[model samples]
Target: MRAVPTLAGGFPDISEMTVARQVHWQRWLAAAAILVVLAAIGRAFVNGQIEWTYVSRFLTAKVILEGITNTMVMAVLAMALGIVLGVVVAIMRLSSNPVLTSVAAGYTWLFRGTPLILQLLLWFNLALVFPTIGIPGLWSVRAVDVMTPFLSALLGLGINQGAYTSEVMRAGMLSVDVGQYEAAQAIGMGRLRALRRIILPQAMRVVIPPLGNEFIGMVKATSLASVIQYPELLHNAENIYYANSRVIELLIVAGSWYLLVVSILTPLQMLLERRFARGALQITR
Candidate 1:
Protein backbone atom coordinates (compact mmCIF):
# COMPACT_ATOMS: atom_id res chain seq x y z
CA MET A 1 0.00 0.00 0.00
CA ARG A 2 1.22 3.53 -0.89
CA ALA A 3 0.98 6.25 1.77
CA VAL A 4 0.18 9.88 0.79
CA PRO A 5 2.54 12.51 2.21
CA THR A 6 0.84 15.03 4.50
CA LEU A 7 1.35 18.82 4.30
CA ALA A 8 2.98 18.67 7.73
CA GLY A 9 6.27 16.74 7.88
CA GLY A 10 5.10 13.57 6.15
CA PHE A 11 2.92 11.63 8.60
CA PRO A 12 4.29 8.14 9.17
CA ASP A 13 2.89 6.32 6.11
CA ILE A 14 -0.25 5.16 7.92
CA SER A 15 -1.58 2.76 5.24
CA GLU A 16 1.83 1.13 4.77
CA MET A 17 2.55 0.73 8.51
CA THR A 18 2.25 -2.80 9.80
CA VAL A 19 0.31 -3.25 13.04
CA ALA A 20 1.93 -5.98 15.16
CA ARG A 21 -0.61 -7.99 17.13
CA GLN A 22 0.23 -8.53 20.81
CA VAL A 23 1.28 -12.07 21.66
CA HIS A 24 -0.20 -13.38 24.96
CA TRP A 25 2.41 -16.00 25.85
CA GLN A 26 1.10 -16.35 29.39
CA ARG A 27 -2.45 -17.17 28.19
CA TRP A 28 -1.07 -19.79 25.84
CA LEU A 29 0.98 -21.36 28.67
CA ALA A 30 -2.01 -21.31 31.03
CA ALA A 31 -4.27 -22.94 28.40
CA ALA A 32 -1.68 -25.63 27.74
CA ALA A 33 -1.40 -26.35 31.47
CA ILE A 34 -5.18 -26.61 31.82
CA LEU A 35 -5.44 -28.97 28.86
CA VAL A 36 -2.71 -31.21 30.31
CA VAL A 37 -4.48 -31.36 33.71
CA LEU A 38 -7.81 -32.20 32.07
CA ALA A 39 -6.21 -34.89 29.93
CA ALA A 40 -4.66 -36.48 33.05
CA ILE A 41 -8.02 -36.50 34.84
CA GLY A 42 -9.71 -38.05 31.80
CA ARG A 43 -7.01 -40.71 31.58
CA ALA A 44 -7.40 -41.58 35.26
CA PHE A 45 -11.15 -41.98 34.90
CA VAL A 46 -10.79 -44.13 31.79
CA ASN A 47 -8.24 -46.42 33.55
CA GLY A 48 -10.03 -46.40 36.93
CA GLN A 49 -11.55 -49.45 38.63
CA ILE A 50 -15.05 -48.41 37.57
CA GLU A 51 -16.77 -50.81 35.20
CA TRP A 52 -17.90 -48.83 32.13
CA THR A 53 -20.02 -51.80 31.12
CA TYR A 54 -22.11 -51.43 34.25
CA VAL A 55 -22.48 -47.70 33.65
CA SER A 56 -23.66 -48.23 30.07
CA ARG A 57 -25.97 -51.06 31.13
CA PHE A 58 -27.64 -49.15 33.90
CA LEU A 59 -27.79 -45.81 32.04
CA THR A 60 -30.90 -47.00 30.26
CA ALA A 61 -32.06 -49.61 32.75
CA LYS A 62 -35.82 -49.72 33.50
CA VAL A 63 -35.38 -48.86 37.16
CA ILE A 64 -33.08 -45.95 36.32
CA LEU A 65 -35.54 -44.68 33.69
CA GLU A 66 -38.42 -44.85 36.17
CA GLY A 67 -36.34 -43.11 38.78
CA ILE A 68 -35.50 -40.29 36.33
CA THR A 69 -39.17 -39.98 35.37
CA ASN A 70 -40.14 -39.69 39.02
CA THR A 71 -37.40 -37.13 39.52
CA MET A 72 -38.73 -34.98 36.68
CA VAL A 73 -42.30 -35.33 37.96
CA MET A 74 -41.40 -34.27 41.46
CA ALA A 75 -39.21 -31.39 40.29
CA VAL A 76 -41.95 -29.95 38.09
CA LEU A 77 -44.69 -30.34 40.72
CA ALA A 78 -42.54 -28.96 43.51
CA MET A 79 -41.35 -25.96 41.48
CA ALA A 80 -44.91 -25.19 40.44
CA LEU A 81 -46.07 -25.32 44.04
CA GLY A 82 -43.14 -23.14 45.08
CA ILE A 83 -43.85 -20.56 42.37
CA VAL A 84 -47.49 -20.31 43.47
CA LEU A 85 -46.57 -19.86 47.09
CA GLY A 86 -43.76 -17.48 46.17
CA VAL A 87 -46.09 -15.15 44.30
CA VAL A 88 -48.55 -15.10 47.19
CA VAL A 89 -45.85 -14.58 49.79
CA ALA A 90 -44.20 -11.84 47.75
CA ILE A 91 -47.49 -10.03 47.45
CA MET A 92 -48.08 -10.35 51.16
CA ARG A 93 -44.56 -9.15 51.89
CA LEU A 94 -45.18 -5.99 49.86
CA SER A 95 -48.61 -5.38 51.36
CA SER A 96 -49.54 -2.26 53.36
CA ASN A 97 -50.83 -4.27 56.28
CA PRO A 98 -48.29 -5.05 59.02
CA VAL A 99 -49.85 -8.44 59.78
CA LEU A 100 -49.48 -9.65 56.21
CA THR A 101 -45.89 -8.41 56.01
CA SER A 102 -44.96 -9.97 59.37
CA VAL A 103 -46.50 -13.31 58.43
CA ALA A 104 -44.68 -13.36 55.10
CA ALA A 105 -41.39 -12.45 56.78
CA GLY A 106 -41.85 -15.16 59.40
CA TYR A 107 -42.59 -17.77 56.76
CA THR A 108 -39.45 -16.86 54.85
CA TRP A 109 -37.34 -16.88 57.99
CA LEU A 110 -38.57 -20.26 59.26
CA PHE A 111 -38.14 -22.11 55.95
CA ARG A 112 -34.94 -20.46 54.75
CA GLY A 113 -33.26 -20.82 58.17
CA THR A 114 -33.61 -24.63 58.28
CA PRO A 115 -31.54 -27.14 56.35
CA LEU A 116 -33.48 -28.82 53.53
CA ILE A 117 -32.44 -32.35 54.55
CA LEU A 118 -33.67 -31.70 58.09
CA GLN A 119 -36.97 -30.44 56.66
CA LEU A 120 -37.31 -33.60 54.58
CA LEU A 121 -36.63 -35.83 57.63
CA LEU A 122 -39.11 -33.84 59.71
CA TRP A 123 -41.82 -34.24 57.09
CA PHE A 124 -41.11 -37.96 56.74
CA ASN A 125 -41.34 -38.44 60.51
CA LEU A 126 -44.30 -36.11 61.09
CA ALA A 127 -46.38 -39.07 62.18
CA LEU A 128 -44.38 -39.16 65.43
CA VAL A 129 -45.77 -35.75 66.36
CA PHE A 130 -49.22 -36.13 64.92
CA PRO A 131 -50.38 -39.74 65.05
CA THR A 132 -53.66 -38.84 63.39
CA ILE A 133 -54.30 -35.76 61.13
CA GLY A 134 -57.63 -34.65 59.75
CA ILE A 135 -60.35 -32.00 60.06
CA PRO A 136 -62.49 -32.03 63.19
CA GLY A 137 -65.53 -34.37 62.98
CA LEU A 138 -64.49 -35.35 59.49
CA TRP A 139 -62.49 -38.12 57.81
CA SER A 140 -59.33 -38.91 59.84
CA VAL A 141 -56.30 -40.81 58.58
CA ARG A 142 -53.08 -41.98 60.17
CA ALA A 143 -50.27 -39.47 59.70
CA VAL A 144 -47.91 -42.28 58.70
CA ASP A 145 -50.11 -43.20 55.72
CA VAL A 146 -50.50 -39.56 54.61
CA MET A 147 -46.82 -38.65 54.98
CA THR A 148 -45.30 -41.09 52.50
CA PRO A 149 -41.84 -40.51 51.22
CA PHE A 150 -43.24 -38.93 48.07
CA LEU A 151 -45.58 -36.53 49.89
CA SER A 152 -43.01 -35.69 52.52
CA ALA A 153 -40.38 -34.93 49.92
CA LEU A 154 -42.86 -32.83 47.98
CA LEU A 155 -43.88 -30.70 50.96
CA GLY A 156 -40.36 -30.27 52.25
CA LEU A 157 -38.81 -29.33 48.91
CA GLY A 158 -41.73 -27.19 47.77
CA ILE A 159 -42.08 -25.24 51.01
CA ASN A 160 -38.35 -24.65 51.30
CA GLN A 161 -38.16 -23.64 47.65
CA GLY A 162 -41.02 -21.19 48.22
CA ALA A 163 -38.96 -19.13 50.66
CA TYR A 164 -36.16 -18.64 48.15
CA THR A 165 -38.53 -18.15 45.24
CA SER A 166 -40.41 -15.47 47.16
CA GLU A 167 -37.21 -13.43 47.33
CA VAL A 168 -36.68 -13.81 43.59
CA MET A 169 -40.27 -12.75 42.90
CA ARG A 170 -40.02 -9.78 45.24
CA ALA A 171 -36.82 -8.64 43.54
CA GLY A 172 -38.50 -8.92 40.15
CA MET A 173 -41.52 -6.95 41.32
CA LEU A 174 -39.33 -4.27 42.85
CA SER A 175 -37.40 -3.90 39.57
CA VAL A 176 -40.47 -2.38 38.01
CA ASP A 177 -40.34 1.45 38.01
CA VAL A 178 -42.49 3.29 40.59
CA GLY A 179 -43.83 5.31 37.65
CA GLN A 180 -45.34 2.13 36.24
CA TYR A 181 -47.28 1.57 39.43
CA GLU A 182 -48.36 5.18 39.52
CA ALA A 183 -49.50 5.01 35.90
CA ALA A 184 -51.56 1.92 36.69
CA GLN A 185 -53.14 3.70 39.62
CA ALA A 186 -53.88 6.70 37.43
CA ILE A 187 -56.03 4.42 35.38
CA GLY A 188 -59.17 2.99 37.05
CA MET A 189 -57.31 -0.24 37.96
CA GLY A 190 -57.36 -1.47 41.54
CA ARG A 191 -54.16 -2.68 43.22
CA LEU A 192 -54.74 -6.38 42.51
CA ARG A 193 -55.83 -5.76 38.94
CA ALA A 194 -52.90 -3.42 38.31
CA LEU A 195 -50.47 -5.96 39.75
CA ARG A 196 -51.90 -8.77 37.64
CA ARG A 197 -52.08 -6.74 34.44
CA ILE A 198 -49.17 -4.29 34.63
CA ILE A 199 -46.63 -5.21 37.31
CA LEU A 200 -46.41 -8.99 36.84
CA PRO A 201 -46.10 -8.90 33.05
CA GLN A 202 -43.24 -6.46 33.31
CA ALA A 203 -41.60 -8.30 36.22
CA MET A 204 -41.58 -11.55 34.22
CA ARG A 205 -38.84 -10.30 31.91
CA VAL A 206 -36.58 -9.64 34.89
CA VAL A 207 -37.51 -12.86 36.68
CA ILE A 208 -37.39 -15.59 33.98
CA PRO A 209 -33.60 -16.03 34.01
CA PRO A 210 -33.37 -16.43 37.77
CA LEU A 211 -36.48 -18.63 37.85
CA GLY A 212 -34.95 -20.92 35.21
CA ASN A 213 -31.77 -21.21 37.26
CA GLU A 214 -33.81 -21.96 40.38
CA PHE A 215 -35.73 -24.67 38.56
CA ILE A 216 -32.47 -26.29 37.46
CA GLY A 217 -31.27 -26.13 41.06
CA MET A 218 -34.55 -27.72 42.16
CA VAL A 219 -33.85 -30.62 39.76
CA LYS A 220 -30.52 -31.30 41.46
CA ALA A 221 -31.96 -30.73 44.94
CA THR A 222 -34.36 -33.62 44.35
CA SER A 223 -31.35 -35.87 44.92
CA LEU A 224 -31.43 -34.83 48.57
CA ALA A 225 -34.81 -36.55 48.85
CA SER A 226 -33.00 -39.87 48.33
CA VAL A 227 -32.10 -39.66 52.03
CA ILE A 228 -35.80 -39.95 52.84
CA GLN A 229 -36.12 -43.04 50.58
CA TYR A 230 -37.68 -41.09 47.72
CA PRO A 231 -37.00 -43.21 44.63
CA GLU A 232 -35.38 -40.46 42.57
CA LEU A 233 -32.56 -41.10 40.09
CA LEU A 234 -29.84 -40.96 42.74
CA HIS A 235 -31.81 -43.21 45.08
CA ASN A 236 -32.29 -45.89 42.44
CA ALA A 237 -28.68 -45.51 41.39
CA GLU A 238 -27.70 -46.06 45.01
CA ASN A 239 -29.83 -49.20 45.18
CA ILE A 240 -28.17 -50.58 42.06
CA TYR A 241 -24.68 -49.85 43.34
CA TYR A 242 -25.56 -51.30 46.74
CA ALA A 243 -26.58 -54.59 45.13
CA ASN A 244 -23.77 -54.81 42.55
CA SER A 245 -21.04 -52.96 44.45
CA ARG A 246 -20.29 -50.81 41.37
CA VAL A 247 -20.45 -47.53 43.22
CA ILE A 248 -18.43 -45.37 40.86
CA GLU A 249 -20.15 -46.80 37.79
CA LEU A 250 -23.61 -46.12 39.20
CA LEU A 251 -22.58 -42.62 40.24
CA ILE A 252 -21.24 -41.94 36.75
CA VAL A 253 -24.57 -43.01 35.26
CA ALA A 254 -26.50 -40.65 37.51
CA GLY A 255 -24.07 -37.78 36.90
CA SER A 256 -24.24 -38.25 33.13
CA TRP A 257 -28.05 -38.01 33.21
CA TYR A 258 -27.95 -34.86 35.33
CA LEU A 259 -25.40 -33.26 32.98
CA LEU A 260 -27.56 -34.09 29.97
CA VAL A 261 -30.67 -32.62 31.55
CA VAL A 262 -28.92 -29.41 32.62
CA SER A 263 -27.28 -29.06 29.18
CA ILE A 264 -30.72 -29.12 27.56
CA LEU A 265 -32.19 -26.71 30.10
CA THR A 266 -29.47 -24.06 29.63
CA PRO A 267 -30.34 -23.38 25.99
CA LEU A 268 -34.08 -23.48 26.69
CA GLN A 269 -33.59 -20.89 29.43
CA MET A 270 -31.74 -18.56 27.01
CA LEU A 271 -34.61 -18.84 24.56
CA LEU A 272 -37.11 -18.04 27.32
CA GLU A 273 -35.09 -15.01 28.39
CA ARG A 274 -35.02 -13.76 24.82
CA ARG A 275 -38.75 -14.24 24.47
CA PHE A 276 -39.49 -12.29 27.61
CA ALA A 277 -37.01 -9.51 26.86
CA ARG A 278 -38.05 -9.03 23.25
CA GLY A 279 -39.63 -5.64 23.88
CA ALA A 280 -36.58 -4.31 25.69
CA LEU A 281 -34.31 -5.57 22.92
CA GLN A 282 -36.44 -3.83 20.31
CA ILE A 283 -36.44 -0.59 22.27
CA THR A 284 -32.66 -0.70 22.68
CA ARG A 285 -32.08 -1.33 18.99
Candidate 2:
Protein backbone atom coordinates (compact mmCIF):
# COMPACT_ATOMS: atom_id res chain seq x y z
CA MET A 1 0.00 0.00 0.00
CA ARG A 2 1.24 3.56 -0.77
CA ALA A 3 2.29 5.60 2.29
CA VAL A 4 0.27 8.74 2.84
CA PRO A 5 2.32 11.95 2.20
CA THR A 6 3.67 13.73 5.30
CA LEU A 7 4.54 17.39 5.85
CA ALA A 8 7.76 18.73 7.44
CA GLY A 9 6.02 18.70 10.83
CA GLY A 10 5.29 14.94 10.55
CA PHE A 11 1.61 15.65 9.92
CA PRO A 12 -0.50 14.14 7.17
CA ASP A 13 -0.58 16.39 4.07
CA ILE A 14 -4.27 16.82 3.23
CA SER A 15 -3.18 18.43 -0.08
CA GLU A 16 -2.02 14.96 -1.27
CA MET A 17 -5.69 14.08 -2.00
CA THR A 18 -6.13 11.24 0.52
CA VAL A 19 -8.49 13.26 2.78
CA ALA A 20 -12.19 12.67 2.18
CA ARG A 21 -14.18 15.60 0.86
CA GLN A 22 -17.17 16.36 3.08
CA VAL A 23 -20.34 18.16 2.03
CA HIS A 24 -21.74 20.76 4.40
CA TRP A 25 -25.30 19.59 3.85
CA GLN A 26 -26.56 21.08 7.12
CA ARG A 27 -25.30 24.52 6.17
CA TRP A 28 -27.00 24.32 2.80
CA LEU A 29 -30.23 23.18 4.48
CA ALA A 30 -30.08 26.09 6.91
CA ALA A 31 -29.52 28.60 4.11
CA ALA A 32 -32.49 27.22 2.20
CA ALA A 33 -34.75 27.35 5.27
CA ILE A 34 -33.71 30.94 5.99
CA LEU A 35 -34.47 31.96 2.40
CA VAL A 36 -37.92 30.37 2.65
CA VAL A 37 -38.67 32.24 5.87
CA LEU A 38 -37.56 35.55 4.42
CA ALA A 39 -39.69 35.04 1.33
CA ALA A 40 -42.76 34.28 3.46
CA ILE A 41 -42.23 37.39 5.57
CA GLY A 42 -41.72 39.58 2.50
CA ARG A 43 -44.91 38.28 0.87
CA ALA A 44 -46.93 38.86 4.01
CA PHE A 45 -45.65 42.40 4.45
CA VAL A 46 -46.37 43.26 0.84
CA ASN A 47 -49.90 41.81 0.76
CA GLY A 48 -50.99 42.01 4.37
CA GLN A 49 -54.06 43.86 5.66
CA ILE A 50 -51.93 46.68 7.12
CA GLU A 51 -52.35 50.05 5.41
CA TRP A 52 -48.84 50.95 4.27
CA THR A 53 -50.05 54.36 3.07
CA TYR A 54 -50.77 55.49 6.62
CA VAL A 55 -47.25 54.57 7.65
CA SER A 56 -45.83 56.93 5.08
CA ARG A 57 -48.40 59.62 5.74
CA PHE A 58 -47.94 59.79 9.49
CA LEU A 59 -44.22 59.13 9.48
CA THR A 60 -43.38 62.84 9.76
CA ALA A 61 -46.58 64.21 11.18
CA LYS A 62 -46.29 67.06 13.73
CA VAL A 63 -47.52 64.88 16.55
CA ILE A 64 -44.93 62.21 15.75
CA LEU A 65 -42.19 64.83 15.60
CA GLU A 66 -43.21 66.18 19.00
CA GLY A 67 -43.19 62.65 20.39
CA ILE A 68 -39.69 62.05 19.01
CA THR A 69 -38.50 65.24 20.70
CA ASN A 70 -39.95 64.19 24.04
CA THR A 71 -38.32 60.76 23.75
CA MET A 72 -34.92 62.25 23.02
CA VAL A 73 -35.21 64.71 25.90
CA MET A 74 -36.34 62.04 28.32
CA ALA A 75 -33.57 59.66 27.27
CA VAL A 76 -30.87 62.31 27.57
CA LEU A 77 -31.99 63.57 30.97
CA ALA A 78 -32.51 60.11 32.40
CA MET A 79 -29.15 58.83 31.17
CA ALA A 80 -27.41 61.87 32.66
CA LEU A 81 -29.03 61.26 36.03
CA GLY A 82 -28.27 57.56 35.88
CA ILE A 83 -24.59 58.14 35.09
CA VAL A 84 -24.16 60.52 38.01
CA LEU A 85 -25.81 58.11 40.40
CA GLY A 86 -23.90 55.18 38.91
CA VAL A 87 -20.53 56.81 39.57
CA VAL A 88 -21.48 57.57 43.17
CA VAL A 89 -22.75 54.05 43.74
CA ALA A 90 -19.71 52.44 42.10
CA ILE A 91 -17.35 54.44 44.31
CA MET A 92 -19.36 53.53 47.38
CA ARG A 93 -19.30 49.87 46.39
CA LEU A 94 -15.50 49.92 46.20
CA SER A 95 -15.07 51.95 49.38
CA SER A 96 -13.49 50.47 52.52
CA ASN A 97 -16.43 51.56 54.65
CA PRO A 98 -19.03 48.88 55.28
CA VAL A 99 -21.91 51.32 55.57
CA LEU A 100 -21.24 52.85 52.17
CA THR A 101 -20.85 49.43 50.55
CA SER A 102 -24.00 48.08 52.15
CA VAL A 103 -26.06 51.09 51.13
CA ALA A 104 -24.88 50.85 47.53
CA ALA A 105 -25.55 47.12 47.43
CA GLY A 106 -29.02 47.50 48.91
CA TYR A 107 -29.94 50.32 46.51
CA THR A 108 -28.83 48.25 43.53
CA TRP A 109 -30.66 45.17 44.78
CA LEU A 110 -33.95 46.92 45.43
CA PHE A 111 -34.12 48.76 42.11
CA ARG A 112 -32.76 45.97 39.92
CA GLY A 113 -35.07 43.43 41.55
CA THR A 114 -38.27 45.30 40.74
CA PRO A 115 -40.05 45.62 37.42
CA LEU A 116 -39.57 49.03 35.74
CA ILE A 117 -43.25 49.49 34.93
CA LEU A 118 -44.21 48.87 38.53
CA GLN A 119 -41.66 51.46 39.59
CA LEU A 120 -43.17 54.03 37.23
CA LEU A 121 -46.63 53.33 38.63
CA LEU A 122 -45.41 53.60 42.18
CA TRP A 123 -43.71 56.93 41.56
CA PHE A 124 -46.79 58.24 39.83
CA ASN A 125 -49.05 57.17 42.69
CA LEU A 126 -46.67 58.05 45.55
CA ALA A 127 -49.15 60.63 46.78
CA LEU A 128 -51.22 57.78 48.13
CA VAL A 129 -48.40 56.97 50.57
CA PHE A 130 -46.88 60.38 51.26
CA PRO A 131 -49.15 63.37 50.77
CA THR A 132 -46.29 65.87 50.94
CA ILE A 133 -42.62 65.64 50.12
CA GLY A 134 -39.79 67.92 51.20
CA ILE A 135 -37.04 68.35 53.75
CA PRO A 136 -38.44 68.91 57.24
CA GLY A 137 -38.71 72.63 58.22
CA LEU A 138 -38.36 73.55 54.56
CA TRP A 139 -40.79 74.32 51.78
CA SER A 140 -42.99 71.33 50.98
CA VAL A 141 -44.91 70.32 47.85
CA ARG A 142 -47.85 68.00 47.43
CA ALA A 143 -46.64 64.63 46.21
CA VAL A 144 -49.29 64.41 43.48
CA ASP A 145 -48.41 67.88 42.20
CA VAL A 146 -44.68 67.21 42.17
CA MET A 147 -44.92 63.69 40.79
CA THR A 148 -46.50 64.37 37.46
CA PRO A 149 -46.21 61.87 34.65
CA PHE A 150 -42.97 63.42 33.41
CA LEU A 151 -41.33 63.62 36.84
CA SER A 152 -42.51 60.12 37.74
CA ALA A 153 -41.18 58.63 34.53
CA LEU A 154 -37.87 60.41 34.97
CA LEU A 155 -37.36 59.17 38.54
CA GLY A 156 -38.50 55.64 37.75
CA LEU A 157 -36.34 55.21 34.67
CA GLY A 158 -33.35 57.15 35.92
CA ILE A 159 -33.17 55.44 39.33
CA ASN A 160 -33.66 52.01 37.83
CA GLN A 161 -30.98 52.71 35.22
CA GLY A 162 -28.59 53.72 37.99
CA ALA A 163 -28.70 50.23 39.50
CA TYR A 164 -27.54 48.51 36.32
CA THR A 165 -25.14 51.35 35.51
CA SER A 166 -23.47 50.93 38.91
CA GLU A 167 -22.72 47.30 38.17
CA VAL A 168 -21.27 48.16 34.78
CA MET A 169 -19.18 50.98 36.23
CA ARG A 170 -17.96 48.73 39.03
CA ALA A 171 -16.89 46.07 36.56
CA GLY A 172 -15.02 48.64 34.50
CA MET A 173 -13.31 50.09 37.56
CA LEU A 174 -12.29 46.63 38.71
CA SER A 175 -10.78 45.83 35.30
CA VAL A 176 -7.93 48.24 36.00
CA ASP A 177 -4.82 46.52 37.33
CA VAL A 178 -4.10 46.90 41.06
CA GLY A 179 -0.62 48.05 40.12
CA GLN A 180 -2.09 51.08 38.36
CA TYR A 181 -3.97 52.10 41.49
CA GLU A 182 -0.87 51.63 43.66
CA ALA A 183 1.23 53.63 41.21
CA ALA A 184 -1.29 56.47 41.31
CA GLN A 185 -1.24 56.40 45.10
CA ALA A 186 2.57 56.34 45.11
CA ILE A 187 2.49 59.61 43.18
CA GLY A 188 0.55 61.15 46.11
CA MET A 189 -2.74 60.92 44.29
CA GLY A 190 -5.77 60.70 46.53
CA ARG A 191 -8.41 58.05 45.80
CA LEU A 192 -10.89 60.53 44.38
CA ARG A 193 -8.26 62.29 42.32
CA ALA A 194 -6.83 59.00 41.05
CA LEU A 195 -10.29 57.86 40.04
CA ARG A 196 -11.15 61.13 38.35
CA ARG A 197 -7.86 61.67 36.55
CA ILE A 198 -6.15 58.30 36.09
CA ILE A 199 -8.50 55.44 36.71
CA LEU A 200 -11.76 56.54 35.09
CA PRO A 201 -10.08 57.48 31.83
CA GLN A 202 -8.73 53.97 31.49
CA ALA A 203 -11.86 52.33 32.84
CA MET A 204 -13.90 54.27 30.27
CA ARG A 205 -12.47 52.03 27.55
CA VAL A 206 -14.27 49.15 29.17
CA VAL A 207 -17.31 51.09 30.37
CA ILE A 208 -18.30 52.90 27.17
CA PRO A 209 -19.52 50.03 24.99
CA PRO A 210 -22.01 48.74 27.53
CA LEU A 211 -23.02 52.29 28.39
CA GLY A 212 -23.77 52.93 24.73
CA ASN A 213 -25.92 49.83 24.64
CA GLU A 214 -27.76 51.06 27.72
CA PHE A 215 -28.43 54.39 26.02
CA ILE A 216 -29.87 52.62 23.01
CA GLY A 217 -31.94 50.40 25.28
CA MET A 218 -33.15 53.44 27.19
CA VAL A 219 -34.58 54.79 23.94
CA LYS A 220 -36.73 51.69 23.64
CA ALA A 221 -37.46 51.60 27.36
CA THR A 222 -38.97 55.08 27.12
CA SER A 223 -41.96 53.36 25.56
CA LEU A 224 -42.83 52.15 29.03
CA ALA A 225 -43.46 55.78 30.00
CA SER A 226 -46.65 55.52 28.00
CA VAL A 227 -48.29 53.61 30.85
CA ILE A 228 -47.93 56.74 32.97
CA GLN A 229 -49.28 58.96 30.15
CA TYR A 230 -45.93 60.54 29.34
CA PRO A 231 -46.16 62.08 25.84
CA GLU A 232 -43.22 60.20 24.40
CA LEU A 233 -43.09 58.57 20.97
CA LEU A 234 -45.01 55.41 21.82
CA HIS A 235 -47.54 57.30 23.93
CA ASN A 236 -48.16 59.87 21.20
CA ALA A 237 -48.46 57.14 18.62
CA GLU A 238 -51.11 55.50 20.76
CA ASN A 239 -53.09 58.75 20.86
CA ILE A 240 -52.85 59.07 17.08
CA TYR A 241 -54.03 55.51 16.48
CA TYR A 242 -56.76 55.80 19.06
CA ALA A 243 -58.28 58.65 17.11
CA ASN A 244 -57.68 57.30 13.58
CA SER A 245 -57.69 53.56 14.15
CA ARG A 246 -54.36 53.20 12.32
CA VAL A 247 -52.70 51.16 15.00
CA ILE A 248 -50.15 49.28 12.94
CA GLU A 249 -49.23 52.31 10.87
CA LEU A 250 -48.75 54.47 13.95
CA LEU A 251 -46.62 51.75 15.50
CA ILE A 252 -44.57 51.52 12.33
CA VAL A 253 -43.98 55.24 12.51
CA ALA A 254 -42.76 54.97 16.10
CA GLY A 255 -40.55 51.99 15.29
CA SER A 256 -39.06 53.80 12.32
CA TRP A 257 -38.25 56.86 14.44
CA TYR A 258 -36.61 54.62 17.02
CA LEU A 259 -34.53 52.98 14.32
CA LEU A 260 -33.47 56.39 13.06
CA VAL A 261 -32.37 57.43 16.56
CA VAL A 262 -30.41 54.20 17.03
CA SER A 263 -28.73 54.52 13.67
CA ILE A 264 -27.59 58.03 14.56
CA LEU A 265 -26.37 56.88 17.96
CA THR A 266 -24.52 53.84 16.55
CA PRO A 267 -21.89 55.91 14.75
CA LEU A 268 -21.43 58.27 17.73
CA GLN A 269 -20.88 55.23 19.95
CA MET A 270 -18.25 53.85 17.60
CA LEU A 271 -16.52 57.23 17.60
CA LEU A 272 -16.50 57.43 21.41
CA GLU A 273 -15.23 53.87 21.70
CA ARG A 274 -12.40 54.54 19.27
CA ARG A 275 -11.43 57.70 21.13
CA PHE A 276 -11.28 55.93 24.51
CA ALA A 277 -9.53 52.86 23.10
CA ARG A 278 -6.71 55.01 21.71
CA GLY A 279 -6.09 56.48 25.17
CA ALA A 280 -6.09 53.03 26.76
CA LEU A 281 -3.68 51.61 24.18
CA GLN A 282 -1.27 54.50 24.74
CA ILE A 283 -1.28 53.90 28.50
CA THR A 284 -0.61 50.18 28.02
CA ARG A 285 2.30 50.91 25.69
Q: lDDT of each prediction vs. the true structure?
A: 0.94, 0.95
Q: What is the lDDT of residue 273 in candidate 1?
A: 93
Clashing pairs in 2: none
Residue-by-residue lDDT tens digits, candidate 2, 1-285: 878789998998777675578999999999999999999998998898899989999999999999999999999999999999999999999999999999999999999999999999999999999999998798898998999999999999999999999999999999999998999999999999999998888899999999999999999999999999999999999999999998988988999999999999999999999888983456544
Location of the lowest summed lDDT over 10 successive residues in candidate 2: 276-285
Deviating ranges (above 4 Å) for candidate 2: 1-21, 279-285
Off by over 4 Å in 1: 1-18, 282-285
Write down the RMSD of candidate 2 (Cα, Å). Answer: 2.8
lDDT of 1 by residue, 155-219 (tens): 99999999999999999999999999999989889999999999999999988999999999999
What are the models' TM-scores?
0.93, 0.92
